[model samples]
Target chain A: MDMTTPLVEMREISIAFGGIKAVDHASVDLHAGEVVGLLGHNGAGKSTLIKILSGAYRADAGEIRIAGEPVAISSPRDAKRHGIETIYQTLALADNVDAAANIFLGRELLTAWGTLDDSAMEAETRKVMGRLNPHFRRFKEPVKALSGGQRQSVAIARAIYFNARVLIMDEPTAALGPAETKQVADLILELKKQGIGIFLISHDLHDVFDLADRVSVMKNGKVVGSAHVRDVTQDEVLGMIISGKCPPGAVAGPGALRS
Target chain B: MTESVPAPATPSQDAKSFADHLRAIEFDARMIGMIAALAVIWLGFNWLSGGAFLTPRNLWNLSVQTASVAVMACGMVLVIVTRNIDLSVGSMLGFVGMVTGLVQAQLLPGLLGFEHPATWLLSILAAVALGGLIGLFQGALIAYLAIPSFIVTLGGLLVWRGGAWWVTQGQTIAPMDSRFRPLGGGIEGAIGTSASWAIGLVICALIVAGIAFARRRRKRYGFALRPLWAEIVLAALACGTVVGAVAIANSYALPAGVARRLVEAKGGTWPEGGLTIGHGLAVPVLLALAVGVAMSFLARRLRFGRYVFSIGGNPEAAQLSGVNTRKVLMLVYGLMGMLVGIAACISTARLNAATNSAGQLDELYVIAAAVIGGTSLAGGVGTIAGAMLGALVMQSLQSGMVLIGVDTPLQNIVVGIVLVLAVWLDGLYRKRLG
Candidate 1:
């Protein structure tokens, strides 16, 4: 297979907070239209790696490339400018505000008089929701009143509305029930169909198998190995996680993971 | 081809009734409790005064006394609605009074050379404008500079008081323009005739009716609306009380030449009933009403008000939403400063002097009024009407206590207790809602 060019490639990304190395020379790459699962246990530097991409945290040393072109991403605003959007675990939704308001918050559509143009915003929200998940109908009620799946839909709508090309989801299904999780998975598929690459950070291996095209495992601030979902078994991935070495089941080669 | 549909759910129906029942119970409890408390207070005062509290003349005096603080409390309500306090209102009022006094007394005649013939009109205009400017300054600093309002306005209380002292050289500026004096000093027309008093009550009724109807229309149209019937009833009761007191005042007259002679004998101790209701109502009541209405509009209709609530409820969330939280904070404090300025003006005008000790301990009353009226100290829920009522209650206690010859120190203690009780009750009510 040709590893010709990736949509985004982070080369040896490292970040240290105070004296602790949160991420140490971790590398990740996503190809166009690919769902990449970043699987790691707690404190395995998975979130830090993705946050570096989303510009929530700046890498102490590394190069991150979008479309194979090197670029600087030092802030979330910078990430957005570079067409990278992150949906945090908290969803960052204002509960008291309606779905339309939640979607357009911080970047509201204003009228000629500089006041919020409610109709225009609501219309835009409806249009975006229809494009992503046509089943979502609760637009007028506050996000706090919305179901978990509906709230997730709104968060996805916000990211997509900003014309994000690379979406990074931090445990999107962490707080959701099974039904809500399914909806989020379907949303991931839908986004992939539209040619948007996704980096899904999750501890759920089942979810990785069901959704991701490629699975990259990180153990102790390092990428252990990456394999296509069809080529790697659950046991093999678990072995790599436990022993930090590629098992015989890995496709890349024997001894792919080394201590 | 017909599949038997499962029976429609009954649990949901039961829940709907349950929720309705709960809401009704909550509202009834609040209304009944408030009414009972009011009744107890009235009866207690009546008994203490040997039935003099219910006498027409004393009751009229209570109504008159309640009006000023009630009006000021209206503005205080909005200020607190945004989860802020205006501790400097008394000092600010003193300063405004000084300004009004200086201007109307022709200390600044060049500034008042205008088309308007009435010096009082120009003086009030200047005072209010100054008050608004002070508000803007305080708001800008609190909202933009990210200063705590408590510190900024505490500093303002001292600054303005000192400024007032400096302006009048720590002396009373007295013998204000006669036209201005009546705005805080009058009774009903034709030696206690009830006509003017009746007119005043009718106007109050009309205002209350207008507000209630407007609110009802909004609620009917599915806008976020307040409870209409409660408001209307409150307005009606308040208006009726005022009117009844005025009618009672009309039934009696102070002994002829008593008030004039008292004023002549002691320059400061003017006997009651010398001035009529029409002239006296304009300054304090009108000032308070205008401030209250403007603030209500700001809180309900303006983006700024919404931001205040959002910030108060959750500062982090508000910041994420791009609300300029710092700017909003400053602006709110500044606005409080300005309102205090207006209050100062009214207090000074009423006394017809910018006395050094004119508004001592008055801030406690206003703040207590706001708190008792349900302006949550924790922030994010309050109303102009509630604050007004709170002020009215305090003023009532003050007037009634004085009539019964209660010691001033004890009166303070009583009012302080009432404030604590009101807050405690509010806490319990909120807990029930939870």
Candidate 2:
């Protein structure tokens, strides 16, 4: 194990359900202060790979490393303990609980008497809201009363509240309006400044170009190539996703490091 | 051509706060509607009976009679809030009453040779414990085995009722020892009744004030609170109405000794104890109130309450959030059974007999009260106050219809219509909110 290794190194990970290989021989590295854009067509193993990282699925073969030391993650709790958090598309929030309660959902702060310390939870919620610079109040009642961006703020706050050092966000800005999207984008920048690595899974090339520091393209359950964001064009990435081969001047131009 | 930009508007800050104020009191619309319905019925009854219906004695009688079902309905509200129902409460009540009767009548004389408070306490404890155990068994089947609570508790309804019958050998157990009767049977003279009413009203006022202050403080501290003035005004109105009711009833009771003195003046027989407080106002009413208040606090002011709401709102989401949904479900059912036990104690005390059929069909009334009180059958929303109001409305219709000489069959039809209308109105409210 190298002390200065990247935060996450997934090597030769493979997962199969009843002999159908959903994810096969995939390897990727995500380092701190870097955004990894995972790109692939739908059902091409991008989500499966991300789920393995988030502990929503187990790999049949391969090793997952956190800071160069191999670790086993069998559940979402395990992932949280390893400082890895996932923000799913559904956002799995209890709609009746207010923003503060949602942010501290499973790990709510408790008073000396073991009751939910609502005041402290509110204070902490406010502090995190300040950090995100969200455009809403935490005490505006239930999450059902919140707008899209406000709900996203709550989801983000939950992950961060638990001190997630590696964030795997599944389409954070998918259904958001333009202003809401910009707010989330700003939140991502804030998180990046705090030196947390992000694995942003998306189908939008525009978001990838706007926010990714590095892009790893997956095709047929394998990482075809990985490169600096500046080294690839949207057209080149699209071509690789469609053809399983890189275009001219792309990171995998001619003979990029063979997998 | 450039896009013309309007002057940057200050962030629309007050709009949300203003909207919140408009919608804050909206949550209690069902409560208001139910109260209005009750008032309209009372006025109609008064008109039909030519003001006799509004007699203080009758009103006091109504209150006492409404208490038993009202208290049971409070617990039912919490049970429904957790997306569960206990159809076996009536059956549980019968069984518990049997336990109470057997303990106080059959077992106490044979074992202790004398009855004391402890004897009654033990009986009550045994009844509650039995109810709790039955609830726990039902909850386990529902929560752990993933069986439907409806089916489990429905089975429980038949099982407990049969158990009650078996325990009593299909006989009515009677004559609860006199020592344990005062808590559920005693009534006072006009002065004592008035004093009790005054004390009860003061306690009610203190409670209302505490709740209002806490709500206001929560809102002031940036937590959600309804409109402050509205809450205070509602509380004050409720207290005033109760006190006024008590005073008016006391005024009509013929001034205690005057009735007997007038009879003697007319050369007629004089009654003992100077007429005995105008129908004695039933001890079960106070007991019911005490039970209702305690249960309401449990449902509203505790973490257990929040858990019930959460599980009722969405069990799957609650589970994923690590809420131990099964345990919560179990606890709620257990609480419901214990409440049914309390109701059994009151009913047994009121009747002075523990018949095998003591609480027959009573669960229907309690459940009807909860549903008519705006508790969603799909769950996640209800209130003890609403349940009490519903029970009063139901009981009032039953009593007033009988008083006004309506046929029992016709009364049932009318009550059925009211229930349907209440449910339809609730559905409309939900649709509008949606």
Candidate 3:
């Protein structure tokens, strides 16, 4: 694959739920070591679009290319196998199990005797949590007992531990405090420095302005436009999100408002 | 924005209550509470029965009676943990028992000759396979077809019970194969004095070694360890219980007539004081314990067990995590069916007969045992050992009431009351913890 080939690409993805188009003819791409912010209102199909990429939902009509090679992602396991990871908006941690178990839910460590190597999992979890949240000490307690930020760290740790090439974080900072959100931003920069691509879904325009390399705005199940972060102001992205108006700096999509 | 990140504030740990101290030691309060409740029931029943309830003979009989329910209850823990129920277990047991009886009494006699060694094994395998298939069918409907488990298993309850009657045309099959009869636990089914003591000592050693191994593992990982005194105390308590049980089993002497017959058959005359033969441990009880251990291992150490709990906790999350939840659900039901099959074998062997009504209402007891043992109907929480103890508690209540000449209807009434009370107490405990 060439350097110009995007690390992840979704072309003309569409899905309908109960005859309503949740995501309609939308396309997005993320380059290696780049952060692409997905901005949209509550019902604007951003999450639905990302969910398709993460293999939580199969697109009705789409082509997903990884490093210029087309691939099929029919389930979450398929997504993980292709070096993709997602931190869902709901965090998606099993509340009854400890942090170590949640972190290694599908990919558990096993002993030579074919039993769960719980201590080994716990040791690894401690190493990850130490970097992600230093104050975290409840390794033995279930995730249900954790605070929102601590739970968010568990979800984040799960995503980053596997050396994911493409990370899709849906509202990563929604459940976190300001300090935790800042920590997430720093972590994202660190990951980008390591050449990992990120698709950041966020409502906070400031978050997009501060961290994203480029922004893609979706409105009413369609991508309004895409632009380099430095080329367009937050107001321009907001106009694209709220109305289907494409700014001069953005490349207009089929959903862009006609003048 | 500051580059340096501030440390998150820690929760206060100023005043530690007794419960906090217990938590520090990682003490399982629910397990201890169940044990205490069991003890109270035993002592209370013993007192009410004029000390007869705690005697070796009664206790031995109680253990044998509890074996079948305990076996099924182990599977029920997994079923309930995954937020599903198998109301057809009892009917399934009856159906499987009838089939096993037919195989051993009629079919096996012809194929393997009258007393062939393979007769018992083949019969049991057939029973288990049949039960598993039935369970899978119900599970498929619930998991793949999207039918609610309650409705599927409720349908199963009626269908399987009718199927059981259809198998024998409402007739009872009698006189199981001699080898198979040992599974039901009569004088022939007892392990006898020396073997019971040997097993008891081995279990004690295992208890001590398990604790030591765990401590060493925790130390290696730099995880917090329970106080050394607490560890020793716990080990001692567990070992004591095992040794005490062995002694009680050894104390339950066989009847003089049976002992005299054995001596005479051995070409020796009975002495003035007849020889004592201790009914050390029943075969069915051993089977139950083995099942308990295996189930506990599965729940705590296997990936399948983890997925079951994760699914129970949050099905959507488990699915998103790449767990094949439908397959897991199907297997869980299949496992439950297999346990019911084994339980059916035990019940049929013990009675030396299989009737359509053999295991009627047993589902209620099995579910009760799991629930009383602290398995949440809300799912994601339970233990095999706890359910086994719960079975023992239920058996004690029933046997004690019988010994005291309580009416059968009143016995059911008392059991119903206890089930509700146990669940209420468990709920209160969870609420307090929250």
Candidate 4:
């Protein structure tokens, strides 16, 4: 239960549907204050593996440990209870509601009269966005009216607002511009400094190289390799993803990182 | 530890503020268009019919007539906003009205040997609850069983209308409890003429206060505010309508014959120097207002309402956010059911009877009203106030046609054409906005 133990230790995770393994024997560990980037091509089981830990899907085979204690995350509520939050690629926001409402969705702050304490939510949203994007100002407008980058700010704010220790962000900057992407990169670094463990899923190698301390590549429902960023090149990770074979020159490859 | 400083630059802030103002003006224009349409209908009919349409008596009658449909439209706004429909509402109304008739006129009176006001109140409650139950059942089937709401409610349309007929063997049930007459706009159910004027002024004042409060709140958050001219224009139009309608109503007194009967029945002197006016606001109108307020609160202020819009906008997103789609759906239908029950009770009470064909094809009218009020068929956009206006628009057309001696068949054709035109105009507006 101390900081020395891995914040999340997901081992040998496997999920199958109709006898087809979507994610097979996937293992990744995150420390108390580190960013681990999970990379793969489309349909490479990258999402399925993280979904098991986020409690959006179940793993037919695997064990998940938090602070060295095994835990079952049967639903999103369960995952939230364990302070594991996911920001899906779609952003998963109700477009008709304002940013404040979206950030506090499913976990609204109530007033003394028992209605939604919108002012409190708005104030907190202001604080979060002020840190993440100083130029963001559309608090009352629905998220649909906000730009893609601003919407990302809301989703990111929601994930971090509830004291999430382990964050799973899938393509957090996919729809963002270069400036917005840099803002998100900065936010990720800020989260890292706060001692949160983040499983960053992205197709952007540049982002992974810049933000992630450790990179894990997946191919065909299995991990290709896990290597520290300083020890391996982006092409080495790409080779593992495309060929399902670890680059021989990598510090941590299939044999060393396999569960 | 430092709080983020508000940007002090003016150029971008002013430009952004102006953009917000422009958007607000667009919204105000839409609302103003609705009011203008209402005026066109009112003045057109008034001019064509020699001012009869604009008379207070006719306006008062119109208000009560629009009450029931408007109340239901408030609920329908939610159902449609959730990307769902309830085609069974008309039949549900007939069925509930029939049951209510039995409870008030026969069942309770027969069982208890005498009807108390409390007993009548209980009957109304029972009828409303029955509506909720029926709605819940249909909603569960649609939400949990995964049947489409359109299909489920369409099936309910047949089942419930059939059930209504079976309840009384196709005979028209009559002689609703005397206490129920007020609910149908009877004299006893009305607010007096002076009180009506007072309420009318209060409502106008409330609208002004509400606008000011919202402006202050938005400003406090640094959001854009509408320009002063747009706000002034909208408020003036709204206040003028309210005050004008009440002034017209205050001008009308009871007809001489009705007044004589009232004088005879109450053994009271007819006031000198002025015509004795009838009661002002009807009970049904009050009921509809309550429904409107409560429904708007549910649709706008409550978490349940926010979820309804969210579910309508993106069901997958809502579900992924952990909203219980099935439960919210069920509750929405249940709320619609309760409103339908109130409508049923009003119609039966007004008519003093429930016929087998009571509320027949009323669903077409109700749905048409909701759509005309800007409840998008595509969902995720609507307002209770808009729906209320829609109901008023429909009722106005029907009443005006009847007054002008238009053929019933021709009236139907005209109304149908207007519904299509309204929707088409909505689409055009949406395109222009884009």
The number of the candidate with the highest DockQ is 3
Models 1 onward score TM values of: 0.68, 0.80, 0.97, 0.90
Name model 3 segments beyond 4 Å from true: A1-3, B1-15
Best by TM-score: 3
Which candidate model has the greater TM-score, 3 or 4?
Answer: 3
RMSD of each: 7.9, 6.1, 2.4, 3.9
- Per-residue CA lDDT of candidate 1, range B1-434, in tens? 01112344556766565434535333444444555666677778899988988765665455555555665566566566555667776777767777777777755446555323677667777777777677777667656766776776788789877887888788778766665665563442123344447566666877787777666544554444446565667577668765654466565555456546544666755546563221222334544656666777666445666666656545665564456666677666556655655665566667777676666667778888777777777766666656766776787788878978989999989988888889998898877654
Per residue, candidate 4 scores C-alpha lDDT tens digits across A1-259 of: 1348898999999899899888888888999779999988898889998888988888898899998999998777788889999999999888877888888777777767666667677888989878777777778677887777778888888899899999999999898878778778888898899999999999999999999998888877877778888877877787777776666655443323343
Clashing pairs in model 4, backbone N/Cα/C closer than 3 A: none
TM-score of chain A of each: 0.90, 0.90, 0.98, 0.92
Ten residues in a row with the worst lDDT in model 3 chain B? B1-10
**Runs off by more than 4 Å, candidate 4:** A1-3, A247-259, B1-27, B201-243, B261-267, B270-275
Report the poorest 10 consecutive residues by lDDT, candidate 4 chain A.
Answer: A250-259
- Full-model lDDT for every candidate: 0.70, 0.76, 0.92, 0.83
Residue A118 CA displacement from its true place in model 2, Å: 5.2
Error of model 2, residue B427, in angstroms = 2.3
TM-score of chain B of each: 0.76, 0.84, 0.95, 0.90
Docking category for candidate 1? incorrect
DockQ of each: 0.13, 0.22, 0.51, 0.39
TM-score of 4: 0.90
- Inter-residue clash pairs, candidate 2: none
